[model samples]
Each structure stands twice: as C-alpha cells, then as structure tokens.
Target: LDGRTVLVTGGAGFIGSHLVDALCEGCDVRVLDDLSTGRRDHVHPEATLFEGDLCDEGVLDAATEDVDVVFHEAANASVARSVAAPRASHRTNATGTLAVLEAARRADARVVAASSTAIYGDPTTVPVTESEPTTPLSPYGVEKLAADHYVRLYADLYGLDTVALRYFNVYGPRQACTDYSSVITTFLEQACSGQPITVEGDGDQRRDFVHVRDVVSANLLAATTDRVGEAYNVGTGDSVSVAELAALVVELTGARSDVVSVDPRPGDITVSRADISKARAELGYEPSVSLREGLTQLVVGD
Candidate 1:
C-alpha cells in the first residue's frame, strides 16, 4: 500500500478507523464519514477527514480523487434498525455502495467493500460458504446482498477491480456498546457492570466471531490480491453457542452477573459460521487471533 492514495469511507467508525491507522504509515489516507455511528475523534491524526454522507456525489468525488484504493465500510449495520426503517437502510447500505462504486470507477480505483454473513440468513449448514443461498431474513441482510451483487456487477460490467468481503461477527476495541452493537460488546459490558447477562431465546444460537484485526488484514489483502470480481468469507471458521460465549465472558471478566434468557428477536439467525477456505487459498488470508485472546484484550484494554 506504499505510495498509494487510499480513501476509506466511514474511516471514523470502528473497523474503518483501524484500517486507516494501518494505512497511514504507508499511504495518503482520506476519510469520508457522516459522524452518525462513527466519531470525529476516531479519525487518525495523519489522515485527511471529509465529513459527509456516502451518497453525496461531491463528497464521494472529492474523497476518491487520485485514490488507488477505496475501502467502502460505511453502512447502517443494524439488523433491527433496518427491520424498522428498511427504506432508509436501503438508501444508505445498498444505494450508498453503488454511489461509492461509481466514484471509484471514475477514479479508476480498486474498491474493497464490506459485506456481511447475514446474506446467508439461517443456513442449514454449519460452515456457510460464498456459494450458499442468499436467503436473507431481514432488511439489513437484503441490503448487504444487494451491495455485494453491485460490487461484482461493477467488476464484471465496468472492468473495475473490486472485491467484496463477507464479514462474520467482527468484534474489537473502539466498538461502541450501543443498541445495535455486537453481542460480544454487549456481553462484556453487562458482565463488567454487574448486570445480568441477557441471552435471547435460550442462547443456543451459534456464530463465528472474528477479531477486527483479522478483518483489517483481510481488507488489506483484498486491496492488492489479483483475485477480483468475487466475494470471500472472512472468519475464523469456528463457532460457539451464545450460551457458551456468555459463560466464557463471565469467567474472563470474573463478574457475578447472572445469565438470564429473554425473548428471541425477529430475523435472528440460529447458526452462522464462515467457510474461509477460498480466502485462504486465493488471498492468503488467515485469522491469527483467537476468541479468548481478542475478548481478553477488550476486557483489559490491551
């Protein structure tokens, strides 16, 4: 990434900010964010910040100008929020991606866009692959599916160098504990605060949690890999039940919070894990951080 001008949309957000930090030493980085879920303080000191929405043509144009790569990370990432306001989510997640692709196309920049495992919905298989049916259960999943398709379309139709990374449950530092935040963050917060760890629907649902550091590594690889016009699942390829996760969190934090069950939320997948063999073989992507190690860092602020 040296001697490159890279634009990271949503660079003020959790995953994007980490990517920007990694690129700042070798590339001229530009960030475009609306500061909605992301923060101004999260922007790296060396990177230029462009505060705006992704759909704004002027902002997109300015950010992608002379850029070698565009990391499209901005999105309405909450399934519940998308369920409630699908039209708004579509405008941001789906339409926003198209806008970014267009801007990157004009600049002749390679685009690495963020995708989600939600597109698989409730898969019958344990470890879902890229070829799995996109049976999205919610508006969020559908929006991401649309974005993923658009990325491939741009690559095929316009000959744009593009790749879509289908991220699993990504958790790490700087991840806010919001209503839409990851379950790992929520569990950690609850344990630390002496509040009962809430589990939805008996907590049997399983998910593969990948650390943000590994996710960043995958993005970096996607930026330069010769493999284009395709999607790859980025995950540890290992999963654990939510109940087991809560137990582990309790043990890690040494919190006396009781584990309690709650009503199941709609559009929640019962199980999800990634089949990352394609990424491993083609992109040389490997997840180095374990769940315990990543969770420990988050708990202790390492």
Candidate 2:
C-alpha cells in the first residue's frame, strides 16, 4: 500500500481504526465515519477524517475521490438492532454498500468490504467453507449477505475490482464493552470488574475468534492480491467453546469471579470454525495471534 491513496469507511471503529493505523504509515489514508458507533479519537493522527453518514451521496463522493482503493467497513453491525429495525439496517448495511460500490466504480478504485460469518447462520458442517450456502437468521445477517453478494456482483457486472471478507468473531483492543459487544470483551469487562462472568447457553457453543491484527493482515493481503470478485473467510481456523474461553479468561485475569450460565440468545450458532484454506492459497493470509496471548494482552495492557 506504499504511495497509495486509500479510503477506509468506518475507520474510527475497532477493526477499521486498526486498519487505518496500519495504512497511515505508508499510504494516504482517509477515514469516513458517522460516529454513530465509532470514536473520533480512535482514528490515526496521520489520517484525514470525513465525518458523515455513509449513505449520504455527497459524503460518499468526497470520501472516494482520488482514492486508489477503498475498504468498506461502515455498517449497522448489531444483530439485535437489525432485528428490531430491519429497514434501518438495510439502508446502512445493504443500500449503503451499493452506494460505496458505485462510488468506487466512479473513482476507478478497487474495493475490499467487510462481511460476516452470521451470513452462514448455524452451519450444517463443522468448518464452514466459502462454498457453503448462505442461511442467515437475523436481519443483520441478511443485510450483510446482501452486501457481500453485491460486492462480488459489481465486480463481475461492472468490471470493478472487489473482494469481500467474511470475518468471524473479531476481538481486540478498542472493541467496545457493551451489551452488544463480543463475548471476549464482555467477559474481560466482567472479570476485571470482579463481577460474575456470564456464559450464554450451556457454554458449549463454539466460535472462531480471530484477533483484529490478523483481520487487518487479511485486509491488506486482499487489497494487493489479484483475487477479485471472491469472498474469503478470515479466521484462525480454530474453534473454542464459550465455557473454555471463560475459564481461560478467569485464569488469565486472576479475577475472583464466578462463571455462571445464562439464557442463550435465540438463533445463536452452536459451532463456527472457518475453513481458511482458500485464503491461505489465494491471499497468502495467515493468523499469528493465539487466543491466550490476545486475552493476556487485554488483561495486562489494562
């Protein structure tokens, strides 16, 4: 990305901010975020910030101008919020993605967009591959699927260069600790606060939690690779149950908090492990961070 002009929508958010920080050293990075769920302070000092709604035509126009590549990360990312307000989510996740595609095409720039594993819903198999049929459960999942398909379609139909990354559960610093936050963030907050660590369901539900740094690496690889019009699963190719994760958190944090089971969220996937062989072969992507190391950093860094 050296000497390249890049635009990162949602660059103030967790994953996007990290991407911005990585690109700022060698590329002309411009961040476009609405601040709805993103923090202004998270954006890198070297990058320029364009604060506006992604669906706004004028905002998209200004953000994409003169850009060589665009990382489309802006979206209404909450599943619960999307379930409650599907229309609003559609406008952002689905329609907003189309706007970005059009802008990237107009700018004659390549596009790499963020996708979600939620598009697979509860997978029928253990390690979900890219070829698996999409069976989204929530409105957020549906919208993300729509966005993912639109990106690949634009590449084929308009001859635009585009790639979509179907990211698994991504966790790292700058990830917000909220009711809707990732399980890792929530567990960390609870453990640090000396509160009971809550585990949804029987705690046997498994997930592939990839670190933000690895996800950033995947993005960088996607941008430079000739693998266009295809989607790749970005993950560690490993899975862990919620019960195991909670135990590890307690051990790492050394918190005197009890681990308790709670009601599971409806339609939660029982198991999710990424089949990243395609990413390895095509994008040359590899995950370097271990779950234990990632948790230790969060606990000790705090």
Candidate 3:
C-alpha cells in the first residue's frame, strides 16, 4: 500500500481510526467525517482530515479526488436508535452510502465498505452465514442492507472493485459510551468506575464478539484482494452470553459493582454468531484476540 492514496470516510471513529493508523505510514491518507459521532482527536496529523457529511457532493469529490482505495466505514450503527429515528438512519446509512458509491464511481477508486451482522436480524439458525436470508428487524438493518446492495451494484454496473465486510459485535479500545455503545464497553466502564452494570432481559442473549483489530485486518485484506461484488463475514466463530461477559468483566476488573437485570431494549437480538469459513479461505483472516485476553488488555491498559 506504500505510496497509495487512500480515503477512509469515518476515519475519526474507533475501527476507522485504527485503519487510518495502519495506512498512514505507507500511504497518503485522507479522512472525511461529519464529527457527529467520530472525534477529531482520534485522527492522525499526517493524514488530511475533511470535516463534512458523506451526502455532501463537494466533500465527497474533494475526499475521493486522486484516491486509489476508499474505505466506506461511516454509518448510523445503533439498532435501538434506528428504531426511534428511522428517517435519520436511512439518511446516513443508506443515502449516504449511495453518495459515497457515486463519488467512488467518479473517482474510479476501489471500495471496502464496512457492514454489520445486523443484516441477519435475529437469525433463526446459529452461526449465521452470508447465504442466510436477510430479514432485518430494525431500520438500521434495512439501511445496512441497502448500503450493501448499493456497493455491489456499483461494482457490477460501474465495474468498480468493491467488497463488503460484515463485522459482528466489534469491541476494543477507543469505544466511547453512547446510545449505540457495545455491551462490553458499557460494562467495562461501569465496573471500572465502581458502578453497577445493567444487563437487559436476564442477560442470556448470545453474541459472537469479534475484536476491532481483527476487523481492521479484514479491511486491509479487502483493500489488497482482487475480489469484487462479494461480501465476507469477519468474526471469531465463537459465542458468549451477556451474563457471561459481565461476570468475566467483574472478575477481571475486580469491580465491586453488582450486575443488575433490566428490561430489554427493542430491536435487540436474542442470539447471534458468525460463520467465517469464506473469509478464512479467501482472505486468510483469523482473529488473533481472545475474549479473555481482550478484556484483560482493557483492564491492564496493555
């Protein structure tokens, strides 16, 4: 990737910032973010930052100019928030993505779009695969599915090289506490701050937690691979319940806060896991971070 001109849309956010870090040294990186959820401080100084929305054609043209590869990572990622504010969800997650695709087509840049497992929407089967029927429950899922379609359509219609990565329960450092914050981030913050953590609906919902670092690796692979008009799952191929995660957090952080049960949030899935066989075979992507080790790292600041 040395000497390549790269653009990351949400480069100020968690996983996007990590992608920027990896691409900054070897390439000329440019970041375009609206600063709605992403922080300005997370971006590196060496990389240029463009403050604007993806729907802004001027911003898109400026950011996509002379770019070789585009990582379209910006989206409204919260399921519950989407349930409450469906229009805003579609605006940013769906239309915003279309705008990005149009810009990529004009600039003739390869794209790696960051998608979500929410597209599966309460999978009836365990370890959901890309072939599973998509029946998204929330507006967020609908928006994601729309964006995924747009990306693939651009690849086929415009002959653009594009790949979509569906990340499951991504968590790690730099994750802020917000409405769409992961359960892991919420629990860690509460436990470390000596506050009780709330677990909704008995905390028995199973989830496949993949670390953010692994997602970054998958994005890098997507950029280099010659694959186009394809979507791959990025996950650890394992499962853990929210109750188990909370218990582990308490044990690791030694927080005195008790785990309390609460009413479940709407649009929350009961169970989720990923079937990552395709990504492994094609991209040689294997998640190196274990849940225990990842939690320990957060506690010890390693």
Candidate 4:
C-alpha cells in the first residue's frame, strides 16, 4: 500500500483509528468522520482528518478524490441503538454506504467494507460460514445486510473492485465501555471499576470475540488482495460463553466485582462463531492474539 492514497471513513473511531495508524505509515491517508462517536485525537496526526457528516456531498467528494482504496467503517454499530432508531441507522448504514460506493466508483478505487456478523442473526449453525443464510433479526442487521448488497451491486454493475468483511464480535482497547459498547468492553469496565458484572440472560450466550487488531489486518488485506466482489467472515473461529468471558475479565482486572445474572434484552443472539477458512486461505489471515492475551493487554495498558 506504499505510495498509494487512501481514504478511511470514521478514521477517528476505535476500529477506523487503528486502520489509520497502520495506513498512515505507508499511504497518504485522508479521514472523513462526523465525530458523533469518533474522537479527533484518535486520528493519527499524519493523516488528513475531515470533520463532517457522510450525508454531505462535499465531504464524501473530498474523501474519495484520488484515493487508491476506500475503507468504509463508519456506521451506527449498535443493534439496540438501531432498534430504538431504525430510520437513522438505515440512512447511515445503508444510504451512507451507497454514497461511499458511488464516491469510490468516481475515484476508480477499490473498496473494503467493514460489515458485521450480525447479518447472520441467530444462525441455525454454529461457526457460521460465508455461505450461511443471512437472517437479520434486528434493524442493525438489516441495515448491514442492505449495505453488503450495495457493495456487491456496485461491483457487478460498475466493475468496482470491492470486498465486504463480515466481522464477528470485535473488542479491544479504545472501545467504549458504555451500554451500547461490546459486551467485552462492558465486562472489563465493570470488573476494573468494581461494579457488578451484570450477565444478561443465563450468561450462556456465546460469541466469537475477535480482536480489533485482527480485524484491522483483515481490512488491510482485503484492500490489497486481488480477491474482489467477495465477502469473507472475520472471526477467531472460536466461541466463548459470556459467563466464561466475564470470569476471565474479572481474573485479569483483579477487581472485587461479582457476576450477577439478569434478564436478556431484545436483539440478543443465542450463539455466534465464525468459519474463517476462506480468510485464512485467501488472505493469509491468522488470529495471532488469543482472547487471554488481548484481554490482558487491554486491561493492563490502562
């Protein structure tokens, strides 16, 4: 990616910032983020940061101009938040993505999208594959599904080089530990602060918690890989129950916090794991950091 110009949408946010940190090292990087959830400080100083909404035509124009690649990470990522507000999510996740595709088309740049495993909803099969049926049970899932289609549609219609990555439960440092954040972030926050680690439902719900760094690697790979018009599932190909994850966080943080059971909220999935065979074979992607290692680093770093 050296000497190539790149655009990272939402490059001030958790996942996007990580991409910026890597891309800015070799590429002339430009970032477009509204800062609704992203922080200006998170963006690398070397990259050009454009603060504006994706709905603005000028902002999207500036972002994609002369770009070699477009990494579309900006989205309303929370399922619960999407449930509370569907239209807004649709506008951003679906419409915003379409606008980005059009911008990339004009720039003649390859596109790499940060999609989600949520499109799988409650998969009937464990270790869901890319071939699995997309049964989005929530508004967020539906929005992502719609966006995923746009990526494929643009690629087929306009010969746009594109790859969509369906990421599993990604967590790491810099992730917000709020109610809308990932469960790992929330659990770690509670454990560190001595707050009761609330377990929704029976704490039996499983997730394939992939590290943010792994996700970053996959995005970069997708950007440069010759594989176009394809969407690969990004995950560790492992599953851990929420109870086990909470216990691990408690152990790592060494906080005097107790795990408590609670009722499950809406938009909850029973289990999730990814079959990353395609990514490994095609992208040479490997999960280097184990859950324990990643959690330890995140907890001890702060």
**Which residue pairs show backbone clashes in model 1?**
none
Backbone clash tally (model 3): 0
Query: Which candidate, 1 or 4, has the higher lDDT?
Result: 1
- Tens digit of per-residue lDDT, candidate 1, span 1-302: 89899999999999999999999989999999999999999999999999999999998999899999999999988887898899999999999999999999999999999999988889977799999988898898999999999999999999999999999999999987764338999999999999999999979888899999999999999999999999999999999899999999999999999999999877677888999999999999999999999999998999
Q: What are the per-residue Cα lDDT tens digits for candidate 3 across 201-223?
A: 88889988988888999999999
**Runs in model 1 lying further than 4 Å from the true structure:** 179-181
Cα lDDT computed for each candidate against the true fold: 0.94, 0.93, 0.90, 0.90
Per-model TM-score, in order, reads 0.98, 0.98, 0.97, 0.98
Candidate 2, residues 1-302: lDDT per residue as tens digits? 89999999999998999999999989999999999999999999999999999889898999899999999999887888898899999999999999999999999999999999999988988799999889999999999999999999998999999999999999999998653438899999899999999999999998999999999999999998998999999999999999999999999999999999999888777999999999999999999999999989988984
Please give the range of 10 consecutive residues that has the lowest summed lDDT in model 1: 174-183
Off by over 4 Å in 2: 179-181
Q: Whole-model lDDT for model 2 versus the true structure?
A: 0.93
* Candidate 3, residue 26: how far the Cα is off, in Å: 0.6
